[model samples]
Target: MEKTLKRLSSIRTESDILREFLAEFLGTLTFVCIGCSANAVMLQMPELSLINGPLSWGLALSVSIYVSGGVSGGHLNPAVSLGLASIGKLQWKKLLHYFLGQYLGAFVGSLLAYAIYNQTIDRMPNDITWPIFGTKSASHINAGSAFLDQIISTMFFLMIICSLTDEDNPMKPSKGLLPFAIGFINFGSMIASFSYNCGGALNPARDLMPRIMTAIFGWKSAPFAYNDYNYFWIPIVACHLGGILGCWIYRLMIGNHWK
Candidate 1:
């Protein structure tokens, strides 16, 4: 405990903390903006959605990480930040700072996307535009199943991330290529599962903050009222659970075995 405190103290200089905050903020903002813009584009081009949605999101994340990784380890997602903290890879003292940046960034990103696409959005129906900002469970699934699906999706994502960055893992990608590799994971995950369930919101910030924007803009009750409000909270709660679970499983099965 004493050693942990000392380590945290040594790194908690004001400048360092501020840099981390800004890095997370900018990284998340870039990611959400690009991803949402893609959604907006897909809104105009429905036939190409199968090829566009996952690919755009994947590239957005890759670029964001490349931009922020040097300064802050590029944890653009609150789920990733919390998961790393749970495993002691991130100091708990910095978690709130990270969360503040991530959430605010997401909100701003959503606002930016809306600003750019409002003209188009205005012409479309609210039901069509809302999914670009937030997520909705598919008609076949209830809130419970959606919740479980998110947990599993995020769990798998976090597990792969943990493995990719594990210092002791023999198969980890080179540092320069890690972001793209992670991006591909996201792309593949989205292709396989993002559409089938709750639109693949592996990150809460990606969903909740934008959802708030939609509510305030013109979406009103629909974003929250969809699925009787039961589905609105699933990604936020389940992803955190999934992150911790993923890290724990990795630690038990692989991390602990590293010599």
Candidate 2:
């Protein structure tokens, strides 16, 4: 018992905790900014095309996780953090801090995206151009379809995350594979989902901050139609529910060994 206690205590320290928080903040910020900014740039380029948007996002997330996984477990998405918590991989006490960090990071990232694209936005022929790459609109589906898409996509995303990170997976040789697996998953999911109907933002933080940024910038210039701003809640609530469902489903299939 004494040896076990020592092992537990030795795993982390207060400084480690502080560093994790900072890493989470900066890593998430970098991811959203770079990914969204790339999308914005693509929108201005007639040669780029919409098909490349999702791929760009996938690559951005993959690179960010590769760089940040060592420090904060690479939880740039609030849904991912919540899912991990439900699976007992993350402490409940730190949930609020992680959520706050991710949200703030995303907000800052959006600001950066806006800043970088300000010139392009100003020169755009219309506000509709902004929604082409951002998360504020769903050109591919209607409201009902958008909600459903978010739910299903988030479910799959969380399941993949839980499975890849699972230690019991005999297939998983080492942690080195995690970033690549996660990146590929994101890339595949985006290609499958993102289109005219919303940008397939499987992440609540990714969706919310950009919407908030659009609102702050004024609806006239905002990309989304905003017929019902409350509609945004669907992604927020559904994503969390999807995360919980993913954790439960993984447990059902693989057993509760994750605990």
Candidate 3:
């Protein structure tokens, strides 16, 4: 009887963990659904998206975090989770769970967005250089500039994220407001970087899964190439490095000072 009770308790604990993972999956899905779909609308109808793109994405992200923050810390982006883990604020063991949830969520979320906007996509001009579901560099920015943009912007992103969540910081935001602060920072980053063809893809799952969706939809290898250069690797590699760098910088500046 005692052993059976212990087994039942363990099962309940496992069930709770699964629920947390489900929360992350649903949160990320909602996050990318809004972000990617907004970009899709911009691609098809720039007029409608011009004013709403950055703001809507930021607000959607805030909502995602608010919905799942208590259960999973609402790490809808892999880079954010990795950054926190690199700083010892998040357990490395939990990374696999978070990543799996985020990637799958982003994948399905983007697909859902595509389903909503396929009509507009079909009507795009052949000259329509805007991305459908994947990121592409703008003409003014070459591969090098685009890569630099992602790396540096991601550094700023993770730095702010870490600072906001830093326990040692005297001005940490209350739980209710942290998501808004993050959303504002994300909006600021987009306003600053999106014009440069950086695509403002701070998360690999956000970039790659949608790209995969495009590929599945028959865009083929084009989503991975821009300016006759294969740039698929830039955002993924740079953001991870940026996260590590941000964690290092934060540790040097504040985390290391903690007793």
Candidate 4:
């Protein structure tokens, strides 16, 4: 009876869940708002993206992680949340809270970006502006190739993320630098694949939510109907699988080897 009562007492309450939800929400919002703002800027000046896109997204992720890492571990992306949960690092029950927070936060963040750039957005062509809110495959790639691209890229991303945050890893960064280190991983990823099959959307919430916003806010169904809707689901579905596989691979290769 004493053990049962102690366990019950230690269980997270509704308030704890709420706090985590709010942290994830705010963190994701910060990430999307800042990252998409950079995308918006690059729409007007395409040449700038070669430098601006990677740097802005990396710093944006770093800042967002710093903002909410204390409260919720700053799994600002659903892929990160799913990966951690799969590895038993996060409670399965908390997946709903994290998903809701991340998706809602991403949607609201897109709205904020829209509010800030509506005038310029209205003047830009749809093709130019839509990518600001969502990813589109480069014409050379088909849906199958794009799907594989997301899987491979996101798999690599989550593998590194698990390494960076693993407490048992000998070379893990200090807590203070973890955010920046993870941010640079993202930066390096973008530099390598930002123009790849689907712009390397490693986070489902980051891609899908903002893509939905583009559909609603004047881009219409073209955002979803692109490539006969075949391309639309690649980022969402592939990232989840990639995240899970990445965590599994990390545990198999490095995490399980830790003493």
- Candidate 1 has a TM-score of 0.93
State the lDDT of candidate 3 residue by residue for 117-158, as single tens digits.
877776754225336555666777777887887778788888
Q: Residue 2 of model 4: what lDDT?
A: 100
Displacement of the residue 228 alpha carbon in candidate 1, Å: 1.2
- Colliding pairs, model 1: none
In candidate 2, stretches whose alpha carbon ends up further than 4 angstroms from where it belongs are 1-14, 132-140, 194-196, 218-225, 257-259
Q: What is the lDDT of candidate 4?
A: 0.89
> What TM-score, over all chains together, does every model reach?
0.93, 0.84, 0.87, 0.92
Ranking 1 against 2 by lDDT, winner: 1
Q: Is candidate 1 or 3 superior in lDDT?
A: 1
Each candidate structure's count of clashing pairs: 0, 6, 0, 0
Q: What tens-digit string does per-residue lDDT give for candidate 2 at 1-259? A: 9999999988865775676777777878888888878777777674775556666777778788877789889888888888889878899888877788788888888888888788777676545555533464444456777777677777788887777777787666368878777877787765445534555777888777776776677545344455456356766777777777877788778756544
Q: Compose the digit string of candidate 4's lDDT tens values, residues 140-242.
A: 7898899888888888899999998888988999999999999998998653465466876889999999999998889998888877888889999999999
Model 1 Cα lDDT, one tens digit per residue, 91-113: 99999989988999999998999
Candidate lDDT values, in order? 0.90, 0.73, 0.79, 0.89
Model 4 regions more than 4 Å off: 1-14
The residue ranges of model 1 lying beyond 4 angstroms of the native Cα positions read 1-14
Tell me the lDDT of model 4 at 232.
83
Better of 3 and 4 by TM-score: 4
